[model samples]
Target: MADATKNPIADLSESEQLELSKFIESEQQKVKLQQAIHQFTSTCWPKCIGNIGNKLDKSEEQCLQNCVERFLDCNFHIIKSLESTRK
Candidate 1:
């Protein structure tokens, strides 16, 4: 991927360049995380809640909460398991 940090504005001041690079990297990471969350939400919402007509009902909301919680739990467990297996 092209480094956006190489532009003239970023190359102007040393501190500004570093700060801009960090900001760009952080924003890219944020976008990636947002995309992942959106994908998970899209898949999980349908699995947890059947059909959607209007605003999310209480039951559907509960299901979404459960989906998020379970997804995090699964991610945590997977990371822990990987660490152990790497030993």
Candidate 2:
């Protein structure tokens, strides 16, 4: 018996199963994004900053921004290249 609230996923209709899968995938992506941001902060903060300052200076700001952007750009390029090769 598939109770609406307790379908156990296996009891779902094909479309419902797919919808659930997409929702889970979206949530997983959000978690991955959070992890990436945490990794970026940990990896970039120390490299760009040494002292505890009242405020971040322009160089520190730029350095952090550039560090994260470069990582994202590299990831994007790699993903694109992989997709092209698969195709």
Candidate 3:
């Protein structure tokens, strides 16, 4: 039987490892962004939409825009507060 605990990434050179790490981190950020967008849409959809319309009326469009803005503002405020606490 062969040992199964080895990591293949450990075989790469230092530069290669760093590059792979950065690439992985970039991909993770993209995934997180996508999840946040989905969550934003999910939360705001039912709140602003009452029926399946051909297109969004002006009020519905405004509501969605406001919802997204508020969501972003809340997240930014929380992040800033956390950073201040860490300092």
Candidate 4:
């Protein structure tokens, strides 16, 4: 586990950097998105694709789109509420 205040990725050493490069190349073969987007997509994908199936249904596809929207909405609501309370 990493410290909450510090970035763990920034602490990688020379050998660790080389290893990370290899790992990232392997991951890139499967994913087009960057690290953060990949993480978000992976988390949201499971939420949207809870069960193994031949393919995603229309509802599951909608869930993937809605998941991103809902996350943005929640962030906006929290910011607005906090601003209102501070006033």
Candidate 5:
């Protein structure tokens, strides 16, 4: 993958450069979101589901939901903490 900060479209026309840049940024954001979702699912799956059943039970479903919510809350808390420390 190319470094997004580097100008990979320098030889392109102005409009083309803008379009490429926007596409690259949108793609990068999509990749990041996918990675985060994979990480969260991997981390929470085993922790939430104890038995290896074919389908998730109600309790298992609730556990998975809570696990994801808690993980997101922790992420937000850490971001807020870092922002406070930066100032």
Candidate 6:
């Protein structure tokens, strides 16, 4: 019997292996996306939200939208800035 702790991939058929690889890749992508969302919310919540209400007011909602846009813009700006210096 194969050890329970051993790599299960070794016992899988080629098709099963391919499916497992694709599943793992998708799961990893989901985890990365979830992490990014958590980071974005954490960073934006304080800057955009105020006075813990039952729901977000329109102003707060707009603030969060703008914050995320600005954050993405900042990331792109930094990437461009670095590329310019590398030349």
Give the number of the best model, judged by lDDT: 3
lDDT of 4 by residue, 1-87 (tens): 656999676789989988999999989865754664675587678788878789988999899889877776886899999999999
Measured on C-alpha atoms, candidate 6 has an lDDT of: 0.92
- Is 1 or 6 the stronger prediction by TM-score? 6
Ranking by lDDT: 3, 6, 2, 5, 1, 4
Candidate 4's C-alpha runs over 4 A off are 1-39, 50-57
* TM-scores for all predictions: 0.72, 0.67, 0.82, 0.43, 0.81, 0.78
* C-alpha local distance difference test of each model: 0.84, 0.92, 0.93, 0.82, 0.91, 0.92
Cα lDDT of candidate 3 equals: 0.93
Candidate 5 local lDDT, residue 70? 94
**Root-mean-square deviation of Cα positions for candidate 6 versus the true structure, in angstroms:** 2.7
- TM-score of decoy 1: 0.72
* Highest TM-score model number: 3
* Candidate number with the higher TM-score (4 or 5): 5
* lDDT of model 4 at position 45: 89
Cα lDDT tens digits for candidate 6, 24-47 = 999999998998788789999999
Sequence-dependent TM-score of model 5: 0.81
Q: Which regions of candidate 3 are displaced past 4 Å?
A: none
Query: Which segments of candidate 2 are over 4 A away from where they belong?
Result: 1-7, 10-23
Residues 1-87, model 3: lDDT tens digits: 756998888889999999999999999999999999998999898899888789999999999999999999999999999999999
Give RMSD (Å) of candidate 2 vs. truth.
Answer: 4.3
